[model samples]
Target: MRCLYCHAVIHEEMSWSDLLFKRIEDPFCGICKSGLLEIKKENSCSVCSGKMEGSGTCGDCLIWNEHQMYHDVLHSNRSLYEYNQLLKEMIKRFKYNGDYAVAGCFRKKIIEEVKKLPRQTLLVPVPVSEERLQTRGFNQTEALLVMAGLKFECLLTRKNEEVSQAKKLKHDRHSGENPFKAIQQLNGENILLMDDLYTTGTTIRRAAHILKEAGAGEVRSLTIGR
Candidate 1:
């Protein structure tokens, strides 16, 4: 097989285990794989999986929990990698440059995490505004889930067109009106929001807020980057 990111051939020797049972090879080459900075769970905050000094929630999560509008809106969030330079460039290419095949590099990890969630939990891809979707040619979050071969409910819609999150300042990220609105009413079903990145987490919290208002229970999130 070829590396998903760099398109190099992957050469592997057959082992006894490989002959005895079916084994799925990694879709990335060593060089590309090594560049991925995975966030170890042990050193991360309980709420957002962000790096922290101790075994507790991070300052950002605490502030969100304390805020009246976002209090307890999101139960937790987990991310696969750090927003390092390599990842930033990859995201820029995949998201802005319309390199849809880049989504394949993350398919295995995203599928694995989704499988670990409860069977009853609903997978929800955070929505993009119509204008943004048209400009980008696709919703990056939805593309990630689709490339992973996962089923997700399009339960939310964007209420307004807004500036890109990457260009938004921290205060601007948090201060804007919530742009998400639920497209369907949930019957207290548990939801797991899927997104490509989590910065200050204003986007996830805003989406979670709308999910709660639409009768969802125990909203959590899984992101490709933190």
Candidate 2:
């Protein structure tokens, strides 16, 4: 077998607990799996789940709230992992290299978190531009949700002129018309926005604003990384 991220030969070895409980085999070897960083509660920002120095919200979230960058902003965001080098590489492979299978690495984790969303929460994915969608041949966030057995709606319709969000600079990302619009009214009580990563919170923030304008309430976000 091979490691999903590294593609190294993996000589499968089961732990004593796995043997005793007949646990489903893990695809990764110990070394590779150990590199998959899971964020601990104490280390993350209360609002954005980014790496924080102490208990309160991160400075970015504070500034965003103070300035109403995303009016009717999200209630909060929950992220599962830190955006470390390992995760960056994995995402690059999955997103840029067209290695779609790597998306399954987060399937179990995403499904587990989706179950915790509030009732009547509309699962809305961050849509890509027509240019990106055409090049990639798929919506990465939607694929992640489907593989996790979680359902989501492609509510936001992105403009044809825009490119991948990853390719934009920070300032450019914040200043644009956001390049997205809601296609249908979301009359749900809660909106749970989904994305693969949360960087400056720009993408989700823009989407959240559109969802609110379309009738979503108490918006929140869930991301694989922050």
Candidate 3:
């Protein structure tokens, strides 16, 4: 076998516990596995899934819930991993460097998580504009989900002449309206917006706003990193 990220030779072995119980299927080798920063089940904001003090929702979500500019969008969000250095490199290679095969690293795990959600899930991936589509050739978010066998569509389109979320500063993101517009209306259905990363919560909030305004019943987001 081979390690997925580093492409090093993976020596296969099993411990005594594996013989008695279920065998371990470790995708990453020891060094690569050590770099994976999974999100711990800790006290976090119910809305954004961010680590915070106490059991209550974080102040950031509270501000979003109360802020006039937010338009009462963004119900809740969940993420699988933290935005650690290792994850940053993985995302860069997959997204910017055009390594589509890296999607396999999270395919099974993402599918497993999606299964735990409510049935009849409307998996709507955040869309890229024609300009970006032409530049990147493939959408990074869509690439991660191509194997999930779930019904999905690009409901949101990026506005023309808009700077990407990546280029915007933290304060700049919060000040302006999102650059996405809904292409269709959804009526009283559960929506799970899929994206690659969750940063200052601006993009997801903006996307959720349009989804809610378009009549979605409940809008939640799932991201690979937070």
Q: Whose lDDT is greatest here?
A: 1
After the best TM-score superposition of candidate 1, give how far the Cα of residue 201 lies from its true spot, in angstroms. Answer: 0.6
Ranking by TM-score: 1, 3, 2
State in Å the error of residue 192, model 1: 0.9
Candidate 1 lDDT at 221 equals: 99
Please report the TM-score between candidate 2 and the true structure.
Answer: 0.86
In model 2, what are the clashing residue pairs, if there are any? none
TM-score of each: 0.95, 0.86, 0.87
Per-residue lDDT tens digits for candidate 3, residues 1-226, read 8777788888976778888895425557789778877765476677777887756678788878788867457767888888899999999998888888777677766876788778787888888778887877898788877845456877888876467778989998888656889888888888888989999898888888888888888888888898
- Stretches of candidate 1 off by over 4 Å are 16-23
Which ten residues in a row are the worst by lDDT in model 1? 159-168
- Please report the candidate that would top TM-score against the real structure: 1
Per-residue alpha-carbon lDDT of model 1 for 1-226, expressed as tens digits? 8998888998878999999996656778988889989998889999999998768888888889899989999999999999998899889999999999898789888877878887789999999989998899999999998888888899999955657878888988888678888888889999999999999999999999999999999999999999
Deviating ranges (above 4 Å) for candidate 3:
11-26, 69-72, 147-149
On the 0 to 100 scale, the lDDT of residue 64 in model 1 is 90
Model 2 CA deviation exceeding 4 Å by range: 1-3, 7-27
Model 1 per-residue lDDT at 118? 79
State each model's CA lDDT, in order. 0.90, 0.79, 0.80
Clash list (residue pairs), candidate 3: none
